[model samples]
Target: MSVVMADEAKDVHTEQLAACVRYVPPEDLKVVAQTYDGAPVMSGSVRGVQAHFREKHPQAVYVHCYAPDLNLVLCHTCKAIPEASDFFNLLENLFVSQCVYSQHDQFASIQEELHIEQRELVQISNTRWSCQLSSVNALMKNFPAVMKSLQKIRTPTALALHSKLSKLPVVYLFVVFKKLLGITEGFHKVLQKENVDLAQVVHYKSAVHDTLVSQGTAQVAEEIYAKAKAACRENNIHESSLGPRRKQKMGDFVVEVSCGSRSDLLNDSEHLKQRLFYPCINRMTSELENHFPNVEKEVMIGIQACLPASETFLCMQSLEKLASQYNIQLVPEEVMVTKSFLSRKGTEAISDILSVFKPLNPMMFPSLKTILQVTLTIPDSSCERSFSSLC
Candidate 1:
């Protein structure tokens, strides 16, 4: 629970971690879990801090912090397409070079003239996906002002940014990412909650996964393309036609052509969806699955079933498995009686449930209380928030 300056070496980390644990009172020094970002010094599978700590405390399981992992999922997904990556890079440059401190009056004046709500452009954070949604929303809300400001400036940076911003693909990407990030914004907030538990995290993660999958379909892509097209028209930005298809050649001889004429070519909307929308959506969905696979593990399932908010709350099979795994003696009749009492409280938070038992004797419901404690000990975004504040 104490923060101290130290080297990045695994040995140093291990020593510092041990010291922190030792600082706790002997009676309360039960280490059930450890959570950290996916840093090599902290999370490396072998000979890392977590590994060394596990050697000493076998009961303390390691959990990768979800907030940063979610950010990684977004970063990897954006990088899957060259166009999407460039668009975000451009967004950062625009914020750094133009919008943040300098030209505030210019942007404000433009916003007033355009009747747009005055809002500052948000700087994107590399390790925070939640901030990206804010940045994108701010830019989208003040799109006309930004473009107008860019137009009035003659500097090389502003001119280059204006040229890129006017393009059809950039506009399409803006709309697409806004929609995609919007879908995950709620889940991101949930992850940041101080009292969030595994059951809530799993529920929101599944919802985000399903929503992203739906976004990848052709119908949704078409709707997004239409929105982008309308934005381009509203801004008076020239909508360029799709470029020529790359000719497949064999030793400089044309083997085949994708289209014989303009009539055979795909429309701009269809082309954008096929080339950009589908690929981006598919990559994001895949990355979400890859980064969060452990949520479906048997141990996690059992833990979820024990939570009051879970759909399978009070499930006997899950409770028995959890008890057996933890070596806790569970009296089924006592649990059923407790369940009837808890059921009357409706779906209360884990903290609320813990408070309900604070006045009761520990021996009355040891298994349930242990499971709840373990669930709360598993980290969420609080660790990341602390690191952010320190940095």
Candidate 2:
């Protein structure tokens, strides 16, 4: 819970982190976990700050913060399609273009005329998926009003933006991301919460992974296109036909092949689904699996099983595994006695469980208390939030 300004180097971070740990009293100092962002200086495996620090404190397990990992999952997943990159850039351009006082006033008036609530456009953030979701939602809700504002301005930039928004591909991408980000919004919020723990993280991570997998079908893509088409009609924008035939290279001779009938909007929608929508969904699910493999590790599984909120709370095998991994000696019979008492209380939070032992002897179930204390010390997004406040 400290921030220090220094050169962004591995040695500097190692020194600062050590200083922070030393600030604690010698008898009470115990670094159970070290959570950090994926910066090269901090997370680089061999020569990184985390590695250097672990030499002095071998018990400190390194954890890459879930919030930033989730952000990377989204940032990389969106890169699966060229159109997604352009789509987010367009959102930024739209937000920046309206920053002028007169332009914002004009857009606000247009919203009033269209019976849409006046709302400021949200700029997409690379490190914050929630902000990206908000930006997409804001643009989607204000689509008609934005088109009218662009038409009234008669400026080159406005005209360009108007043309881009009126296109079938852009609108289709809009629909695709709306659903994608909507599915991610819940998991994103859970990761960013102040009190979030390993148990909640595991739950929501699996939930989002399953949801993305379930929604990757061609039927879902077609439904998304239908929504996009309806949005185009609502704004009085005619759907554009598919692009020209794609040129192919065969034995050094260029051959032009028709992708589909250019006049068929249904064919165009199918092409967009195959090319963009399904790939985006598939890439997202893959990234989730790649970035969060640690959640399935034995130690993490044991941690989740120990939490009262978990369905498998107080699982004996998991508890033993956790104790062994951390080298905490626990008497199984005594632990089960505590578990039996806690099962009746049904406490949801680590703090509540700790409170139940306040009246008992300090030596009673000492290992269980130590486990809970270490669990409580595991960081979530609090450090990230603190850094954000500095900005």
Candidate 3:
């Protein structure tokens, strides 16, 4: 699709089409290929073919084309020169045969990878569903004995089972959950002969919820755009800005995103401006550091991010406090809200955050602190205790 490649293709094709020499059947070659002295019959026969194609088909190459392959051109006298048309026929057939053979070799590999991926999906579903099926089978065996008191076992337990069934991917799990839980929940209607209109109402309510959710995103999207427009106007800021230059230091970093369509998702352009931060579980950054020293670096930890608008400031303060308690250095930065060539995006805030937390993280470890404490415990405990008593 590139211009260079297109030009090359045209050049190659034009050259090949122009160079296409005439081919005659073996019986007709007497008048074409040679005269009495076994030389070409006409003086201009060889070079004239190039001139003929250039004049007639000046726009594109068409010589040595393959009608059988549904392709316009496969070979031409400019590149893959053939002594005769019969020679080209043989070569084209061989090429197709080799192509089919290569495809056959690759077919098995493609199928094998697909099979492995499919098996992983199947195994994941099967193991998770096995527990559900076993429980259902046990429930079926107790059905007749508990027919009178089925209402007792059905309500609370069935609702709980229904909640769990929602997570399962299998359709049969949903069917079984419905059937067994119905046998438990629907016992009142079956035994006492009351109306099931209330149950139908619940189904209608569920349908309404799903319908609202399906349309919720589009409705919210309209309001979001209106809010953005209002905010842009209220700040008393121009649509365009001309700010001064930013000054940064070593180790200062920012994530650059060319927000083509996602510009609206960016609430602020600052270095560390808190957005909709989701809480995630934080774990150890390392493991074997306890035994040797550095093996714990491989561990991944989960951390909570502040969200809900009001909590952004609280989370920032908590982050600073947490860093200080552990002697971790942190650098926090502000948000960039203007279209300026020179403004550094909240650099000062980010720098302050990073500085506060940088020292705390490494020193927070219990083992490191214990090691330091033991080392400073002193060689003479008796003299140290006596000196402390005097004090």
Candidate 4:
């Protein structure tokens, strides 16, 4: 319905959009709401497209794409955790060289040898977190097979890469992020579903928050170490450690521990957990919380005013404010009728509320139908996916 242009100036963009709206016949162009990425340019500062659109198209409402915003948050978080960024880079390189082209046969052979499924590695995309996650999961599932494949390559570069991959730091990060990404990927799928409802959006956000809250740093660190140890055992790879350093004539010499069976193994585990494991988990959770703010309050308020079918999380102030925002006059008799209908219906959903009142005469219901239309129209994030497809 829209065209992309190089000029991103708000006035120019909005002007073009306004022209398009004008070009459409008045009867056909009904309920013009815009759904866009939640970037500064679109919802820029105080005076942005949201404001401009409101002024021009009085009935139009602006909605931000929730999933894309969450994706952006994860994108920034990847940058924040250097180890994770490096691991993701490794996954991309592995995918291109081994998964896609040259050594794919070798990888498949190794997977067969290891008695694992012959799954192809996922290709990573800049915009898709799910891609990154699937890539990580493939790597984790076939880590031993992948390492064995590299060893069988009989190339200096492959051998050197194998050496780098054996390090504890890399392995620990791989395991930690693998679990975290699994959680996030689930959330992403739920948000992008077609039947996703307004109440479910609020419900899922709380569920994610609670899940993150339940996973404490120490517990997460423990889980990471356990997984890393299991991977080491399964692969028959010796987990080496930089053992104690002793004073020498040359200054100091550090001894290397070949097997991770030393008395200070617990100490080593704790040290790694403190240094690397805890920080990344904290960063991701904090960033997620910051990005997914409690829009539930305002959303519930608005819904209650329009639908007023459910009493859960309802506030009178929110109802009044929402009414003012939509310029709807909430007469006492109308409120009584709405509440009485709800009482008989026994707390119906927004869609059901709309259907219930749809058959009623407009003269008798007046503002109720308008409220139902506005309230039932939940903002969707699927527009971004559709736009990406067109591009």
What C-alpha lDDT do the candidate models reach, one value each? 0.69, 0.71, 0.24, 0.61
Top of the candidates by lDDT: 2
Worst 10 residues of 3 by lDDT: 277-286
As for TM-score, the candidate ahead, 3 or 4, is: 4
- Misplaced by over 4 Å in model 3 are 1-121, 125-314, 329-391
Model 2 regions more than 4 Å off: 1-27, 246-267, 293-296, 346-362
Q: How would you encode candidate 4's per-residue C-alpha lDDT over 1-391 as one tens digit per residue? A: 1211111113423422211121111122444345556666666535876566667665555555576656666678778866567777777877766844558888887788879998887877776668877888888888888898888886776786787677776777778777777777777887777545444555566577677656646877787888887877777767777555433353475445434532222226787786566766677778777666433355446664443334542244555555565677755576557556655655444344445445545576666554545554544442454434322
Model 3, span 182-260: residue lDDT tens: 3223322221221211122223323333433343243333443344334334322233322333344447665343434
Candidates ranked by lDDT = 2, 1, 4, 3
Position 259, candidate 3: lDDT: 34
Distance from true position, residue 120, model 3, in Å?
10
**Candidate 2 TM-score over all chains jointly:** 0.83
Cα lDDT tens digits, model 2, 1-391, are 1111112213324422212221111125566667666777876779987788778877666667677778787788767766677789999999998998898999999999989988889988887888888998999899988998889887999999998898888888888888988998988888867666665677678889999999988789889989988888898988756566568788978877555423222337778887779888888888998887452276676676655656766677776666776688867776777777665655543333234434334377677666655554554432565455322
lDDT of 1 by residue, 200-229 (tens): 677678889998997788888888888888
